[model samples]
Every structure is written in structure tokens, then in C-alpha cells.
Target: MTSVLPRTKVSDVLFSCCQLLDISVKWTIQYDSPPKYPHYDPGTSRQLLCDQCPPGSYVKQHCTATSPTQCAPCPDQYYAEEWNSNDECQYCSAVCKELQYVKQECTSTQNRVCECVEGRYLELEFCLKHTECPPGFGVAQPGTPESDAVCKKCPEGFFSNETSSKAACLKHTNCSALGFKIALKGNAVRDNVCQENTDTTPQKCGIDVTLCEEALFRFAVPTQLTPNWLNILADSLPGTKVSTENIERIKQRHSSQEQTFQLLKLWKQQNKEQDMVKKIIQDIDLCENSVLKHIGHPNLTFEHLNTLMASLPGKKVGKEDIERTMKLCQPTEQVLKLLNLWRIKNGDQDTIKGLMYGLKHLKTYHFPKRTIQSLKKVIKFLHRFTMYRLYQKLFLEMIGNQVKSVKVRCV
Candidate 1:
């Protein structure tokens, strides 16, 4: 072995040294080289690398052998955020939708950014209102731009009386702590009601509270009557007059129906039930004359005629008469035809009184006995009240204790 190395082994060792030297040179070159930029060859049709434009700018002209690439800054409403070989800057086209506002303004290097306006949150690329906790629940975490409001049920000893997006559950009043007896226990939806320790007598009930509330609800005063009529009603109440401010506040705080309901509730609290009923009756009487004057007919309008025709006994009116009445196109004309037929059938009984009697006889009639009595009273008092008064009077009487039994028989 010491005498001489084999020629093949020496040759192999030389080849290995040459390969390592080549790899080392290549690695050194690659490590020392500058970073490659995005490039385009333009019309050269050759594999050539060219300098790229930096962020906020775009290439105006590709680099040639003798010159560097020409670049230009992006104009207003344009952006170019990355090193690029693009011919032109991209448009800043993002637009804020309804209930949204720009959180970050567009710039030469960046696109516009948007966020939801106050009281809303982002959801699936759309702005939506934050959830409001309903009565008996409270907000646990307020909403943010990216998240909806978090709500939780009010725990024991806590209450939340109103719907809210931000309000937390409130601790119920401790009547014992206040040196008073608890008149009513607290629940999630309402606070504990407290009274003096000395006051032990039970509270007096007023006008079958449940029945009265049901009657008030059925009245539908807001839908049926006008603001002027509401004012008149407010003035007619027996105790302290409802101020214009109070009415406005109620109207602002509640829907039309709720406004009327709240006002009725307040009035009920203020006056004796019997007095309220009596006053309502008197008001109705005053309005009846007005109703009659406005209608210009003591008997009924076309609507009333329609009801009468529908309720008439088939034996008395006959199918032919009913068919003829239905065939008439105009409501007034149909009513006149029915009246003529009715008059022909009965000589002296064709008047309003007779019509009332006939309507009463029909077992399937819609009008209640109270309505009949009110209509009869209207007939008796033809000499009194204005048309407006009569109309209101009739409506009030209809909505009284017998409201549940009442129906709009004549529109």
C-alpha cells in the first residue's frame, strides 16, 4: 500500500475534489447576487429580467439595454402596494354601503377600508343592527364592530324591565332594607313593589281590572278615532286634565294603539270606575246628534241597508228579491231597490222602526242588544246632538261593557 496508490483510486479522489470546488463556487455566486425583481421583456421576445417598480408606483416603460425602467407614482384613487411590473396602477374601487362608513381612507399604496356605523356590526360583508335584549333579559357584553351584543337571562334577584342593547340587569329593590314591607314580589320583568309596614289593608279592586283592560283593548280608539277626537276624550276625563305635553310624550313613546291604551289606563287610575262609565255614557249621548246630522238620514246609510238585506228572512224577502238586490251595481241603488221591495211586502212597516224590528227577529243577526238599544236611543233623540257628537256617542256606547259582544255590522 505504501509503495504506490492505484491510478483508478487517485483519479476518483481528484474527481470528488473538482465537484466540491464547483459547488462551492456556485453557492458563493448565488449568496452574493442581488435579489431578482419582477420583470417583463417588452417586445424583445427573449428571456430577459428587467427592474420592477416599487410600491405606490407603476412601470411606465420597461428597461432597455441602455436605460433603467421608467416608473410613475399612482394618481388619486389608485394604488400599487407591491413591487410590480404592472403597466398601470389598480383603481381604489372599494365603496362603503348603507349604514357604513370609511374606517381607513384610501391612499396611493393601499385600498379603502370600511366599518359599520354606530349601533351596528359586520356580518358576512354586510352591516346589521346589534341584537337588543328583550324584557326579562339584559346585555352581558356590548356590541363591537366585529361582534354582536351578548345577552343573558336576568338571574334571581335581578330584573330588566325594558328591551335594550346596552343596559345590564338591575338588582331588585330590597323592601326590607328600605324599612318597608314588600307589597308585591319581584320578578325578572318587574321590580318589587313596596309599601309602608303600617299599611296592611289589601288594595281595592277597580272595575274588574281584567275586564276593563279587555274592554279598553277592544275599543281600538287610536285606529277608529282621529287626534282631535282623542284630545276631546282627554279633556272629558273627570280629574286633572291631560296636558298637551303628556299627550305628546305618550304619542312619542308608544305606537298609536299603545298611546290610547296608556292614556285609558292613566285615566282609570285617576277616576272611580262608576264615574268613568257614567261620563263615557254622557259623552256618547252628546255625540249621537252629531252623527245623525252628518249622515243626513235617520234610518241608516248604504252599509246599514246591506246588513239589513243580508239578515232579512228568506221567506219574507224571497230569493228573487235578494238576487235583484245583489245584481244592482251601485250600493245606493241596491239599497233603494231592497227598500222598495220591503215596502211592497209590508205597507205600514217599511220605516226604520220596522227595519229594526225585522233585524231583531233574525236569529243570525250580528248586532248585539246593546247596539239595538243604542240605535233605538239615537232614533228617540233625533232632536239633540251634532253629527260628530252622535258618531262619537255611538262608538263610545259600542265600546262599553258590551264591547266584546259588538261587531261592525254596518262598516
Candidate 2:
């Protein structure tokens, strides 16, 4: 019979050989087949399935139990540019032109936004330079990063001669208040030029002694004098004074009884002559009024007057107080009437007739009883020596409203 061999497992074969080689033995089992998963050295081998994507590429798919990580290059205008675990590339930030700046910064998922820089404006996708308002035009609205500037033609008596971004139209120059003659009148694009006055040196009656003596007699004699009227006349004359020496001189001139009677006769005649002179004066005042009216009284608008009333340099009329008064008196004919009254009461009218000249220009149809009473107070203010300097100051402010911008003239 053939020798029968007992079936033995592979593990037992090693143990059986070990037992034959030694009297007593201990065994440690080891496998020679490869491991279930592949192995690699981190320092020398290729990247494994779990490794991150390298620079300039992003992961297209995640690593799975059976597959390695899948990757793709960054598309145009997008970038990874570094080793990352991100699922997508970053979008490029905005590259603005010289006239623009970044309005919103870029993010990994969002694109950058841009805007026009200061002194420049935007137009569609690109930024364009702003155009300044030219001569004869004024700024209607200022420019911004998202919108272009708006301009309008200057109104009558307003002017502009240079390019500017947001400048308002300048007013024409006033020659009368500056004690200068108008060398050249202004228009919508140019300012008036002034020249020195070549008229009489003595501001009162052109250096005539007779007129000076007449003015003294009209203003000083206690029997003929009304204090309010006399004071206003003194202020208007520019150089005449109320003094004891002048009174003595007048007294000496009329020392004789015959001369006194002759002085009385002359006074009476002059009074009649003054009435006749008033008519001529009224016509002259009308001519002056017409000059301003024809020019649309460019400085007399509500806006111009409001600015002047609120920005004068000194304490003649309180600018803040007047502005408050203006607000209180708005939405009625009283507003325009008050403005005209302010003009009249603060003006140095040479005669009472001249003081009343502003009345015709006022609209009295809707005036309240309070307005009429207020007008009386205005008339009272007109006839005071204390208000003389104030009147002159207000007059200068009036001229300023009608005058060109100081910046343009200085330039």
C-alpha cells in the first residue's frame, strides 16, 4: 500500500518544520504577500489620492475609496496659483484706469467693482474726464463718480468768464457805491471795470459857498429845523456839520434887521424852488430806477438779497436777525415790500421825495395792517443820525450782491 499523508494547512507546515529543527521552539508568523493597499514614501514618491492639488490647479473631484484626486488648471481671469484644498479658482481683482479707483474689492468668488476718482466722472464701463462749465455758463449741479456735471446759462446781471467745476455765476460790478465811475459795463460773461471819480472834490454841492450857506440855513435855524429831517440831511451831505461856529457865522451874516428880512425872503423862495427841484429829482430817480430795472436788478432777487442779508461782515443789520425776520414774513406781499422798505429805509435819500420813491415799486394790494405799521417804523429809521453808518454799510452790502466774485477779480 502507498503511504498515506495527513492533510495539513500552510500555517501548520511552518510550525511542524520548526518543531523538527529544535527540541523546544517558539514561532512567530510572517506573511510574504503584498499588503491590501499601496504604500509610498512621502519624501520621494508621487502624491497619493489624499494629497492636495498643487499650485495653478484646483480640485475637480474629491478623492474616493477607489480613485485618486482629480484636478484642473485655473481658467482665464481666474487663478489658484498656490497649493490649496479649494473647490474652485479665485476671480481676478479689478485693474482700474488712471482716472478711476476700486469701489468694491474682489473676493474669491466675486469680481471687483470700480468708480471714477475725484475730479473725474464715470461714463458706462469706463471712466471719462469731467468738463468744466465754460464762460457764460454756471453750474446747475456738481459732478459725481457716477454722473456727469450739469450746466446752465447765467441769468441777466450774472457772469462767468473762466472754466470751473461747480462755481455759481458771479454778479456784475457796482460802480456807484464804490465812489468810482464805470469804465466798462458788465455783461453775462465779463465784469465791470471801475475808474476814479473825477467829479468835485468837496462832496457837498461841488464846492459852492452859496449852496453851503443855503444848506446851513435850511438845516440849522431852530424856527425852520425839524431835528429828524435836519439830521438825515446832514448825513446825506457827506461833509456838512452841525456846530456852534457855523451857527455863529449864520447869526453874524443876518445881524442887520434888513439882512434878516432878506434871508427870510430867500428861505421862502428856496422852499418854492425845492418843490420845483423835486420834480426834476423825481425824474432823475426814475431814470436811475429804469437802469436797474432794465438789467433785471440782477442783485435784487430773493436769493441774492437773502445771501446778502445773511453774510454781511459787520453788525449794521444783524444778519441772523434779518434772516429770521425774512422767514417770519414769507409767503405774502409783505416779503417783497419789506425788502423794498429795507432798501429805502437804509438808503441815504437826499430829499423826502426820494425817500418815498420806493413806494411805487412796492405791491401794497395784499399788505396787512401790521405791514403798514412796520413801514412807519422803517420810515422812522430812515430819519435818524444813529442809522447813518448802518445805512452806508447796508448800501455797500447791496453793492456787493451786485458785484463780481472776489476770486475772479483777484485771479
TM-scores of all candidate predictions against the true structure? 0.35, 0.27
Q: What is the overall TM-score of model 2 with all chains considered together?
A: 0.27
Cα displacement (angstroms), candidate 1, residue 317, comes to 56
What does candidate 2's lDDT look like per residue over 1-411, in tens digits? 897556676556655344323311211122232112232434545534354555445667655555655555555566554555678888786497767788876542245667888877877676776668999998888888888788889889878877888776776655554445677888878867654454622221111112112222222223332324323322332222333332333343332222322233233223323453344334424433332232222223344344433322222334454555545433332233333334323432222233244333333333233433443444453444543443334323322432212111000
- Residue 301 Cα positional deviation in candidate 1, in Å, after optimal superposition: 51
Compared with the true structure, what per-residue lDDT tens digits does model 1 show for residues 1-411?
568779999997676456434533544464564224545455565555666666666777777656776666676698877767888989996688878899888876788988899899999988899999999999999999889999999999988888999888877766554435677999998878765454431212111112123232334453354555546557655565555655654564554545665566555434424564555535543443343333223344444555665565432556566565555424323433454465435432323444456656544655444435544554444433353344445446534543333232210
Per-candidate RMSD vs. true structure? 22.6, 29.7
Off by over 4 Å in 1: 1-36, 40-54, 61-70, 82-85, 174-182, 194-411
lDDT of each: 0.57, 0.44
Q: Mind sharing the TM-score for model 1?
A: 0.35
Q: Where's the lowest-lDDT run of ten residues in candidate 2? A: 402-411
The local lDDT score (0 to 100) that residue 278 gets in candidate 1 is 53
